[model samples]
Target: MPQTIAEKILQNHTREEVRPGRIVRCRVDMVLANDITAPLAIKSFRAMGAERVFDRDRVALVCDHFTPNKDIDSAEQVKTVRQFAEAMGVTHYYEGGNVGVEHALLPEQGIVGPGDVVVGADSHTCTYGGLGAFATGMGSTDIAAAMALGETWFKVPPSIRVELYGTPQPHVSAKDYMLRLIGEIGVAGALYKALEFGGPAVEALSVEGRMTMANMAIEAGGKVGLFAVDDKTVAYARRAGRSGNQVMAPDAGAEYERVVDIHVDDMSPQVACPHLPDNVRAVDEVAGLRIDQAVIGSCTNGRIEDMRVAAAVLKGRRVADRVRCIVLPATPSIWKQALKEGLIEIFMDAGCVVGPATCGPCLGGHMGILAGGERAIATTNRNFKGRMGSLESEVYLSNPAVAAASAVVGEIVHPSHL
Candidate 1:
């Protein structure tokens, strides 16, 4: 009768013994929305005639996706969220200069934590699971309901246990590990199921690496991706200025619908080619494939570690003359840190455009949009057709090392080539 970590967290919030498939109403520790989702949520909140949020301090609004406002329409959309945050007296609202991708910012700000239930209007809200939180995404209306009630109902999902058996090889990072999982599981492999990453290898991943793993869980159709709260989680939470003692893990006898074990040492740099996250292949498989653009940022693979790797690969190298390389920090704080560390200067010196800490170009919002028939190699998550621009364009997803190396050569290549 033991429960998984996801079940335990959800049960704690509901104050009840819960199991997969059981419907339960749980209190939410955090509720988040971005420029794109907040407007619809605000309308729903107003439609409910709710003048006050269940807990103003618990609700956060971030203007990341389309901020720095791509156009008047985007500006007005963000303005709506801004006004709503103001009227509601929400203290966590962030915009302009301070804005960051919600998934990345929430954890960095200490707004999400272990054993908490966080709901955001972003699929990658699951990213908080890296800290052992029970977090997930929902439609704007559902988010609005959470805003009004500070709680929502959920059908607890069954769990899938992913055990990492060995340490990753150098330069073979969590991004590569995740792509391998997606390739094995297919895009819909874990549909509506909790993906619990555990075992020695996962325990060895840095918080940034764990974040990259959890952030892409949705790409495999997972309801949530969770890592047990270990010393690494505590260290990360403490570093983010939060008490990190909220340790939680699945019981020894916890049941899982399925278990998949991966030997990380056997893996290499991987990329999800155009059209699907599960369409993964090794770096050598696609090496020498031409590309017109290369981007190194997103909620996935945009941490300082990612930046450092890209900078290491591009230190004295120039981006290929025909290629455009763009670097975006996931959060303003990370941006400033990169600046202090001179990673920004290194990128600019290598002929890359150091962009604002927005979700720019990740979702085709702006900054590095590709033209027809163009192809890009990016460290960002997702590579579906038209994900970063025209439908005729293609996106190949990889880790920052591959992204940086490709930027230099104007072709998909591995860091070893540099």
Candidate 2:
């Protein structure tokens, strides 16, 4: 009878009790769309004959995907979407790196909170679960309808409880532990279920680290992923302009489909090999793999805390002569924080390229392109083929610490070694 952060949020929004396999209608507090998906969502809403959005304040249009418009088609598409939002009188629209990723941008602002049923066009919308929101990704068509009706249908998802216990070794990160957990569960093991991360190991991670873990839950096929809003949540809330609020949590006897235990006392760095997320291996096994570039940024690892760790390695040291290391902040706010913390100067002194506060190489649209058959290592999510910048290029995924150490050595090396 244990509860999960996801369940608690859903229960708050529950107009009626939902049993397994039953469809439930819930009020959506916010609906989001981005460049890659916003056009379709806007079109669908207009087709539905919505004279105006259900609530202008409740709908957010972000242009993170193909941002800065890599080409004319992309630019025109954004222009059209912006015109539509303006016509609808929606003021929640965010453009350029100032907006950042939807999930990252929304939560970093006060637009999302506990017990809110937030829907987004992008699958990683689940990242908002970090704050105890009933956040889930939906198709653009569904998002459009939600924008008009302020409600959506969902089949109550089953639950998977992951209990992680123990402390992280030196230089280890939430990314490493999550990679190991997903490796054990496989990419599809948690499909259609809410993954609730818990136990001592989870508590040990900083709020930023917990966000990193929850942000990538969709990669493991989870419908949503969340962590308890404990003191760490309070800390982040204070930073985000919210001093306090009644947070949400699950009932004491809440039900779950299954529970799994993960131990991290002696765990090592974990890596996701190319082509798939579940393709995992120990970092030692893949060490010495030559890398042409090292990227550190994204919604996954682009926060100020992440920059502090990466800078600790890069400060007073130089990247490998043959490697190019790019560091991008996730948002303008994060970029400002980096400057205030002197992390930006450290990166520049280390010869790392400072990029605009954007998704950058994380989505493979631009930055850090490798030659065909060339290899690169990055702290970004997904090492899938062509995920970095080149179709024939190979990529390896690791935590920022490993990426920094590898940049210093010009090959894969655990950060603990340095």
Candidate 3:
């Protein structure tokens, strides 16, 4: 039977005939949990009477959510995860200076690669599908079981083929494409389905861009977002010191639940308005909407490419006097790279605050919380009510370029307007 990339990966892991809707137990290549979720998973692990993880090297514990100890509660949370890691001798434990956002850190460290099966306690774990992996997020309890057994059950999901045919225009990015897609399909459009991204544009997109797109697939209710392994995938794995193996792609006659084609030649930078990711509009449609804050980082857009784009826009311009612009680098390494590239200097000169690597403020954790009635434009993924602060405050989601441009103008605007 013809199979898609997700199906192929699942079949390879289980050595079984896998098909959509079939429940199969597959070996997990990597299992991850973060400070926010790891504590609960650890509790469950203890309840299971599992003293050690199935494979210490395959388990990762990241402390990125509320790290730097936002408060006593968060501090205690990290303490629990840290103790668990030490007790288990987990090889991929990360915290303090070594911590990076779990989704970004795993790929950067070569802890996950092509055709791997990865399950994490956070939804954005789907980000690894950009590397041609079968990755998904599960509940903390499910993660606990996976850690103890090195295997998990999955009901194989049908696939959605998203074919991209044209190059994006200047200042437009994969974020825009993803927002546009979510807008077209609505949040529940691809529920429990794998998103197979391909076509000419997929090959043109950078690995970082693909990662950004895959990161947001969950917003569209996708089970996972996958791209076929190619030269770029191999090179990315090589840079991370992994020999990309088990590389797979869909068969020529692979079946899909549905097919959607998106052409981006004339597409504009897109933004998601308050309350829902599917509430997207072209930037021009909402230009001049004053913003109180501008954030340019998160797991979604916190890569080096995003930092360079923001720096290019903020090079000599200062942020608006009343608008606070905050930039986070997602991981310590990305932060250091930005500093070496002088992007940090540019941001500081522009009056933007450069924060440490954390998921801070994205989930209303801390650092740049919004006050009631305030508005923010951010490169972060979601814009749900109270996501970054007061329920009365609003968030507009955009790519880093648009967020930086908005910061300079203190209003939502296209990068070209700057």
Best by lDDT: 3
Candidate 2 residue runs with Cα over 4 Å from true position: 1-4
Q: Write the per-residue lDDT of candidate 3 for residues 17-74, one digit (tens) a residue.
A: 7999999999999999999999999999999999899999999999999988899999
List the candidates' TM-scores in order: 0.98, 0.95, 0.99
Q: Tell me model 1's lDDT, rounded to 2 decimals.
A: 0.90
lDDT of 1 at 54: 97
Angstrom error of the Cα, residue 60, model 3: value is 0.3
Q: State residue 325's C-alpha deviation in candidate 1, in Å.
A: 0.5
Q: How many clashes show up per model? A: 0, 0, 0
Give me the overall lDDT of model 2.
0.81
Global lDDT scores for all candidate models: 0.90, 0.81, 0.93
The residue-level lDDT of candidate 1 at 312 comes to 92
- Per-residue CA lDDT of model 2 for 237-347, tens digit only, reads 767777555645566777788898988888898888887778888889888888888988877788878888899988889998988999987777888889999999999
Superpose all Cα atoms of candidate 1 onto the true structure and report the RMSD in Å to 1 decimal: 1.0
lDDT of 2 at 321: 91
